[model samples]
Target: MNEGIGTTGMAGNDHYRMTVDLNVLDHLGINLYSNIAAVLTEAVANAWDADAENVEIGIDPDGKFIEIKDDGIGMSIEDMNTKYLRVGYRRRDEDQETGRTTAKGRPVMGRKGLGKLSLFSIANTIEVHSAKNGESHGLRMTIDGIHKSVQDKEPFYSPEKLPREEIQVTNGTAILLKDIKRQRLGRGATALRKRLARRFSVVGEAHGFKILIDGHPISTADRGDLPMVQFLWSFGDEEPDLSSAGQLLEREALSDRLDAWDGDWSVTGWIGTARLPKQLDSDDAGNLNSIVVFARGRLFHENILDKLNDGRLYTKYLTGQIEADFLDADDEPDIATSDRQRVQEDDPRYVQLIAFLRKQLTQVEKRWTEWRRLHEVEKAKETSPALAEWLESLPEGFRKSAETLIAKLSALPVDQDEDRKLMYRHGILAFERMKLRGSAEELAAHVHDIDKLLAILADRDSLEASLYRDIVKSRLDAIKDFQGIADDNAKESVLQKYLFDHLWLLDPAWERATASEVMETRLTTDGVLTQDMTEKERLGRVDIAYRTMAGKHIIVELKRVKRKMKLLELQEQGQTYVDKLKKILLAQGDATPNIEVVFVLGEPIDEEGSNPERLKSSMAAISPGSRIVHYDSLIRGAQEAYSEFLKKSKQLDKLERIVDRI
Candidate 1:
């Protein structure tokens, strides 16, 4: 016996009849297909090799059975024994020597002669029925029989023959597999039909070939599942002798030649990019990123995407097919891996293909990067005018980087437009900060004029401005209501509540003040203030104090908005509160406190009022740190600042109206 062959029997003349080891069938069957699609693709490829005009696949509703029938040159019993059943046959070697072509003048798609074993990947039982000439035959094979043959030490076993009455097809072959082993998820008739469509590029009436799942034909015209293609590049136009009907039309090509690589060998067919990534939804199959590799008009490798992984953003948008028939040329070494899922990645031919793809990928990446930038800019315009302005403000270097980032973000796993907006907004603020940092003089001035300078510090065009403006306007409204207070006691309490949140209404300088806590009990204990008087006669006196960033203690005394004030009386009352605060600090042995007192009275003395000049002198003569402010004065400054901002604002009017309604 030969090393790779086995003797099944002896002829009468003493010649040994050869057969493959039964273990070869088991090995090929289990390792051949990763899924039902691969198995069905093998059957379809065999039909194409036989010059089939129509191949139909039927899936049983219960999912336990499938039928693959083809209208082709069916095999007689002798042809089946010698050719169809031969394992590991070198069909390409025979075809090259004989110059064999199918009846339709189509190149055969089968190589390695292992496609028949793919049937066992899905089912335990296979029933094959074929007819040649006027005679018909039927046979059944099972996994158990193959196992029994190996156990019995039988080198090979032949399928049982069926009488003419058992034959179902008259001029072709029908293969039925029942009791399927591993059904693919969502493997129904419709899904199978779509997979078939993606797996083959030459299934059409124009090529005199048709494929149907159930009754639905997988037609090239049915492009509903395909991504929206933008450009096509064909590689086979250089030599007419090597061209086939399956090659893309010259009119459809973006370029007649693939300029990335100039060599004796080049791949022919078409590769294209979608307008957008097809994997933009979780339900998407991620087919658009694949470059399906075909040989002899059938998918030999599903994708070469992994080989050209240059970390480019454009790869997500790419999807197409390239038939590198030179890979299977007689002179080339057999580089296809045993499972047929991929070829040897290290093969010189494949390395060349990958190198060429890397260069081509860069071209598409640049194009896609530009497309995405324009697309996102337009979307920002529709979503937010401010965002559009911010995007345009980006410097050229940074803008190009942002465009590349946008092109790389996956649209799937979740919605991406909202994510894009978030990233864009953050980028805008960061760039604005960087630009502002470059101006040392402006940054120095911002410390003293923070309220007026916020437009430069903050990203004013950002949508967050709407929220900040609403807050400021609401505080203004609360302060306006304070002007109508008549009772001193009621007015004092109302002012405390309003001023706590509306510190900006008093003076923008107080925006960073700590929340106020009442110190009435402490003041009373220090003997600097009295708490026994009536709430009315007491004038609702409350001492609210806070420490500044420089550690200076400040006391704020509130008077009713309607109360008339004498400058001398206001000064006297503030002096008592400041004295008490100083005593408490000294008693605790704290660092000598630098404290200031502020009197927020209802009104300032009028010029027409008695001794107005004397009142002004009285206030000026008080402790240097003590100052008097009218309620009207505090509100006026706040109102003026807000009015100036609103006058300059274009997009914040909505915030103004919302505050008015509040």
Candidate 2:
């Protein structure tokens, strides 16, 4: 049976007639060209296969007509009828394997003969005029004519011939499509030119190929319009280096392992990240975050960068292309999808190609992390005066260690504000950690700093450390404010507020403290420590309570900043509070409640006061940890500590203001 035979009624000549279903042509035509660019690309490919040195595409401003003209070997009427009109014709079968190249020795870019139908995708009527050997032939193909042929049980359309006057060129073909269905946007020509540049890499005089859209030729120079490539990696044998354009470029080969695929399969290309995300115009073609894949010099896919699944923040700022010609090899199955928009994910070559890309992408991610970290350190030095001073304060050896810690913190991919704040906090921690490095017990107690730094590197967080860190920062601001207060009551109020919000400020060890009570708040209306304290406990209380990790009890008392006290009176009050605390702890079944009391006063006690000598002896007789700190000395020490903290945490300009509010 003939290939075109159909199960139709027999003709009058007693032969079964062949027929085609009209719906097939309609479906293909309607679905083929989703946009005007797709149809134009197919026409250009056909021209490439025809050995055309130049293909001119012209579109009417309003999109009423489109014409694709090529200077190549023109098809005669016989060739058009036998080959061009045959749907799905195999071009490879027409000639020997060597015939895969045109007369000009260009590898044929067309395979299935369906490219001719692409003209129908955009317009209903297509006029084809051609000349070969001084003889000209022409035909007009209309969608209505094809439908009529199908209804008439005809297997193919019989195109009507046109007069010779319409054949303008010699030895070439021109296809004019009229009655366009879609209106062209004013920017369509420019957009199409850019897309065409990205879609085909073999264009330019080097290959004797040129595609002109609306008289504007798309040349290799158009590649310059791509994003600013800070660093480029060339991953194949002698692949073209990106136009330097005065940017630093890193060229290298694909790792031998990833390139070790069988059957001469290899992926070759360069991937580059923009210095900034918005450096590239993001439109229909691609954004900064795009990696186009080309097979046989034609785009098989775009935006494959997003498919790598490597969670590098810098990936969103990348743009490049990879050419895997093996996917389009002669013996390989067509892995490209029907729309030419992407490749079949399950194709073995595609799977291997993605695997290779993943490996390379991971390397790219690591390199970006290092680059950004170094950049952040540079930024910190430029923006933070405090950090500069802190760095100077370090000894040569410790300075190097501090620099390493800063780099680690800067590399964290946190938000802009948090990232800088973390750098600052870690800076202080780094200094402290180094200072206590020799004291094993002290270092362990303050290991939160070291732990937080490591947690950030691991993309985790130590919530307790962060909480106490914030408390310290805010309390530092409060202490600064308290230093400004000269009024006795006002200083007391500020001190109380500061201590209430952050008891850990006096000592980070207090971060584990269970409760805090102002001594006066425990006094009842009857002037006794009541069994159950009421809201009146707020009347006065300067005590903050702490139970160490080892279960030893501690109490801290605050005195008015400007108040002077008698040594005996202070001792009597302290002994009374201690007695009450002991009764409470002992009643809870503790055979011994190891207790320590600290008195934080605003001024030094009268040095020549009565019993001053006795007071000093009694204080030494009591717990050695018990001590008195004048408010002035305490505020000065706190200020100096925070100043050191500020210097160490150099990039904390934003966090400084935020903490001041607290």
Candidate 3:
């Protein structure tokens, strides 16, 4: 059928006609590709097939269009109608005598002749201009027009020809895309450069192929990962240059062969692990925690790392590329999926590749663990010399276990170096405590045994004193936080919340435990505990509550920082709480319930018209264990109590120094 619909001063026979099946366009173009990068890769691959030396991509954010211009042997009007516009044109079969290579002796990257259709996946309209052999042609294709043709059941669709004045480039072809599907180019040109750079292997000066975005040429550095690679391993004949790996490289295994399936299959590429998993993550270039597979210099599989199912810890920091041209060899069956983003898992070649990768990962895991362990130990020692001395003091067997523990801590994906150092400091203290308990091996095996470490901290022996030192240091930090709040003149409830959870802040000896819910409920119901406050008390008042610790009941009343109450009023408040609690305990069949009332006030008591000693004595008479403490005195007393223990506990001197450094 003659599908020509426009006259461009050329002969009617030279008009462009596309005789593609409507179903093929829907299957391979409109619904096949998913993202801009994937669709753009197809165009770049086409440029490679055309033997393009320089391909420049210009993205116009304001114009809402993308222009890809290449310098290559462009097609004339005759070649456009017979080959360029033809569907399912197999270049390999048509040019078998030339071995599917371009005039420049480079293997072509196009085979199915369907890549042009992928343009429809991203752009609603496409414009093409090309010139060669003293003749040039331009044509435009719209998705809406194709859809209309499909609805009309037309046998062929003819694209509108561009006039001679619209032909801009004279030596190569330029394709302009408009009405893009995406709302915004995610991560912008920098990210696009990195992604495109990673997809092709022959995109540098040596290969004489260049792909530029905006004005900058994409090079190996645009891959955005080699500098972070601490360890690398290469397979097959070619070993990639590691000079870009910089001084971070600790070791490398180059030119290693994958001798599988009787050596019939051949692949080339290198895999590497970064020093930290965070190094593999990028705000612009996306995650590098993958092993992308490429065939015939084009991405075949986005990532085969997940398919290998290697559950080792090293995988998070792993990334690499494997070039297996045999997967796309002309003599072999097609193993690539329809979209060409991945390979068929059921294919025997892919199955074999997975098996080989798993075996290689095992070796990588072993080496990665050992190298990380040595590196972590050195870093820990540099951060804390006392920790280094502690490690050196250990016996040969214990020292080896400690090193392994350090390695495990380093690989924990903790983002901050200071946080990691804190973990190391605590880990050493737990290790020492475990050693005294003769369970050091358990600590080494289960480094995250928080409950076991807590049990050790609860013990009060000299051997476990180092853990106590760490606990005291943490409590001191909490006190410092509380001091900041009080200095800011925070609300009474804010201070109450802090003290209710951390009873040790009041008394270092009083650790928090499960309070009797029944007693609290009874106190609330009997009006002994109330949220309501009088107008005078609303300015500031003490909230009374009780908690049980170490077989003793302690009732704490937190007063506002601005409150000023007389000692008699404080005495009366303590007496009421004591009397009500005794009645409840007596009802619960305990006549001798040991209760202590601690009144924590922001301001000192109003000891008016009475001796301070006698007023205190009378208050003590009412509640035998009652005591009034100013906020400053309470904090000072707790600090002194812990500081006294730290000074006297000479055995924890080394641990104290390590904790200080952390």
Local distance difference test, each candidate: 0.63, 0.65, 0.78
Query: How big is the positional error of residue 256 in model 1, measured in Å on the Cα after superposition?
Result: 6.3
Best by TM-score: 3
**Candidate 2 per-residue C-alpha lDDT over 459-500 given as tens digits, one digit per residue, 9 for 90 to 100:** 424433434555457767777666665344454445655664
**Model 2 segments beyond 4 Å from truth?**
1-20, 97-99, 151-153, 183-186, 221-226, 244-249, 256-259, 374-662
Clashes of each: 0, 7, 0
- Pairs clashing within candidate 3: none
Q: How do all models score by TM-score?
A: 0.58, 0.59, 0.68
Best by lDDT: 3
CA displacement after TM-score superposition, residue 260 of candidate 2 (Å): 3.9
Q: Please give, for residues 1-662, the per-residue lDDT of candidate 3 as tens digits.
A: 55644665466567587655676688877778876777889889888888899999999966489999999889898878877778667787786654378888887777777778888887888999999997888999998888888889988778999998988888889999988777435667888898887888888888899999997899887887787798888887675766678836465564344654645577688889888788889876678888888888888898898888766567888989888776787767778777788888998778877877887778887787678778877877886777788788899988887887877787678988789888877787778777877767666655645676456445536653545555677777877887777776666668877877777777766674657778878887766776666732653334566689877887888777777877777777777778889999899898998888887778776573447778669667766777777778767777776786566545646656756676
Q: Worst ten-residue run, lDDT, model 1? A: 240-249
lDDT of 1 by residue, 186-295 (tens): 54665566566667768777678999878778875343223355444555673211122332212232332355544555677666555556432223233546787776
RMSD of 1: 18.2
Candidate 2 Cα RMSD (Å): 16.9
How many times do residue backbones clash in model 1?
0
